[model samples]
Target: MEDNYSLYEIAVCELIRRLSNKDDCKRYHEVLGYQHRLNHYIIKCRTHGEPKEFETQFNEIISQLNRVSLLELNVSFNDICNNVSREKQDDVVKQIPFIIVAMTQSEAAKLFENYNESEKLKLLIDSISKGRKTTHFIRQLIERYAETRNKWKPFEKDSRTISDIINDLLPKLIKILFPIREEEANIDLIPDYYESAFFSSNLEERSEIRDYFIQRDCIFIVDTISLFNPEIRDRFLQSQLAATKPIIGILPISKDSMAACEIIEESIKDKFEWVYERYQRKLEYNCSLEAYSLPSFNRWLYKILPDIVKRIPQAAPENINKMKENLKYNSKGFQKVVLSMGGAK
Candidate 1:
């Protein structure tokens, strides 16, 4: 981001985004039509209206945003109505800071700098509502994350082979995911691409890949961001019939949020009507999802490893302690990590 955008200013924009995002502002959409009007209003704030007037509609948003941040400011409603300048209306919010406002702009920037794509994604998702009571569901999501994959079939009598298509798609996959500067998310995309290729291969070929991974005790994972490939979608639908592997998917991005999220969603939205439908079914979707991420998944594994080791009652304490120091993860990893407490003494 440019220096012209202060972290405080960015946070304010983020608040603006949340108030208009499909996931966040369903309460306001039918009434305020934020979906269609938000960008127009942003432009209006610079021209026909002043910042103070712009914030007049944000009283409820201010209250809503208060729950997500660590701050609990007690600014009066009167202060919000007054004491705002055209150039620095966000200054008023300095007293009642939202997500990034709890700290100094510099402090917030430093904190944000360390956040990976998945972490930031989680933060943005969590900030949607004031509620924070889903720890158990999150644990379940992490458990599911350790076991997931997809399957695809090749086009009949196609001039090109499945491998040829995968070879072509591989370069494009790197090209898109590399634009993401966040290293963890970028690296995570590697397994997703290879997993997609594995699914797209013939049964014999896929079995080979599956055997190798199964022997190695590796789990295949798919995160947010699939391409606009119909074959992939059809393969996914076909695979779901007898699917033993439980899969968890995240919607690409809300209609708003980070600029990067919008770009990613827009590019692939056409191919993922199923995902978009899930977002549109917001309340139901929220009920089903527990918001798991890679870091949280690792933590879940670490937390459960001690109990898992207990299952191997005959195992040496030193060996069990060593295993606890470095936990392993995947579908098979989940099977091993989630062992029973009742065993031989």
Candidate 2:
């Protein structure tokens, strides 16, 4: 049960455990091979069949696969959640702040503008200000503000003659909102404060902020692969991978298209494969560049549930039995699985 085991391996192990007779192992292996072949067939058939006919056949095959996979694994909802939590907690050295970096300066600017126009920044400020009278609140707020600006939007608008809105406003606001001690007020650190408290001053400033987070073991989550230009993507990959912290780059691909993966590989060359292989070995899941459809994801979930159940320490016998029963009936569709797991709120 090393964390490096893939979901596929976990599912296969669970399937082996559920076999009543040891002789059935060969039959089960053959079935698994058949299912793998079927997956490839379905992928191939996607380009050939007539729209309506293909849809019907695809749905049927997916449903059948889901059923067989669930029956073979026989896991519960509580078990899946418990295992996921345990795996997740193993990495929780601290609450690693996920800084989501956009693919381009324009996108980053848009996101930053959105935060200004929207209630996000206001809400964040309000939450931080409420019910806490700690001496470090101002420092915390400054750090958060600086981090957000650097991660989301490092480039200043060329059209703007003035500095950033937050940059111009913070000093005055800090003086008005925070009671400064006499000793603190006399210190001539306004220039240094401004430099440390704001981003968009220079490229180096942005990089410094990124390095700060990396040193703290923060996870940088890049938004999407579809939006990245070659230069931006390469720089991002270089910076993120060079860091001691973990990076989770989400490639939002179409249901059955490899365009995203192709674009990524084109951008980063063999580095894409290298990162993926590293993820598979260290992160306990395959981050291989592939177009993962909804059905494929669901099938994975179905297979892994039994292994998850086995990992949960406090699972009551009756509840575990009920979960297995639910899985037997509800594993046909992802929606059914959700509903079977107490309607999923």
Candidate 3:
């Protein structure tokens, strides 16, 4: 049986060789344009005689051309690898902020575990105020916490009220965190709102104050007078417009302060709208007065003091304390009210 199988394989191999040779001959004749001319010459030679000289010369020329074209195209493997690496790096850079933002609450907790709550809060606030690319992610984390749990409350000191802690630490913290630069716009506190005679004086007398307001990038109105009186509100709005400076009004609220609050709200809306139209730009005007009662205001102060510190990078303890003293003196015996504008919401 083995011998018979071997004989069959030999016969099939011989048959395949014959068929392959026949196909190759047919293909060689048909494939090349020069094959037709060669075939015609071959037929002529069969009928007449061989052209030895021309055939030898053509063969030699084809051999020389083949030898000349032997060099393969060069490729730089290193260059290709380097280009791919550069593209990958750029993609990673773009994704970094998003990756940070997408971290789970547990992941964020672990990332910040080394720092105390105050330190973590400070870092977050700093990251936000510096307009770091990572700010959006940080904000997302905060919002997520707010949604799932309550807002992340800061660690309180045992001896001091949150307000007192803020008053003591905020100014120094801001100065340390964000140093003043010559190119940066000034951040000024309107320490005593009553001392600003711009509202009572004519436009001419307020030129210096107007110019001062114009040059600043941010102004903190610490007093409550500007919010209630229409004329003072108009002047404040005008100053902001002249320089495109942002004003943060902090008003202490009380039972009798409703009218003032209404006036302030209207003034804010009017000014914001006017600015939007004049500049052909949209602006956001947010007031949280509705959400704040006296007790709630104290809590709000605790929650927002970090943000306020971030915004007013130039806040100094001396300036803040001076404002507080002036406020105390001017108020006589009214309950402390809190109103703030323009910071993280």
CA error at residue 36 for candidate 2, angstroms? 74
**Per-residue lDDT for 1-345 in model 3, tens only?**
123322322332222232233356763333343333434544565456565743553344334324223232012223333333332221100000000001224434444343235443344334333454454645443333221111221221133322333334433433444454322312332322212334435676566655654543322322222232334345655555322433233332333445545554454456555543433344322223232233443344344443433443333445555554543533222211111233111
Report the lDDT tens digits of candidate 2 across residue range 77-176.
Answer: 2355444433333110111133444433453334434433535333432343454553344333222222232333211222211123223332333343
Instruction: Give all TM-scores, in the order shown.
Output: 0.23, 0.28, 0.27
Report the lDDT tens digits of candidate 1 across residue range 1-345: 234543343444444444443655555454244323434544567677577765664444455544443232333322322222122221110000000001122322333343344443345435422254445423322332212232111222233322233334433433342343221121111111235335545877655654444322222223333322233445444433112222234332333345535544554345444444454343332211121333332333233323323322243444543443333323222111111122123
Indicate whether candidate 2 or candidate 3 has the larger TM-score.
2
How much does each candidate deviate from the true structure in C-alpha RMSD? 28.6, 25.3, 28.3
Clashing pairs in 2: 75-306
Worst 10 residues of 3 by lDDT: 92-101
Q: Which runs of model 2 end up more than 4 angstroms from their true locations?
A: 1-95, 104-201, 238-244, 265-274, 280-345
Stronger candidate by TM-score (1 vs 2): 2
User: Sorted on TM-score, highest at the top, how do the candidates line up?
Assistant: 2, 3, 1
lDDT pick, better of 2 and 3: 2
The stretch of ten residues in a row with the least summed lDDT in candidate 2 is 186-195
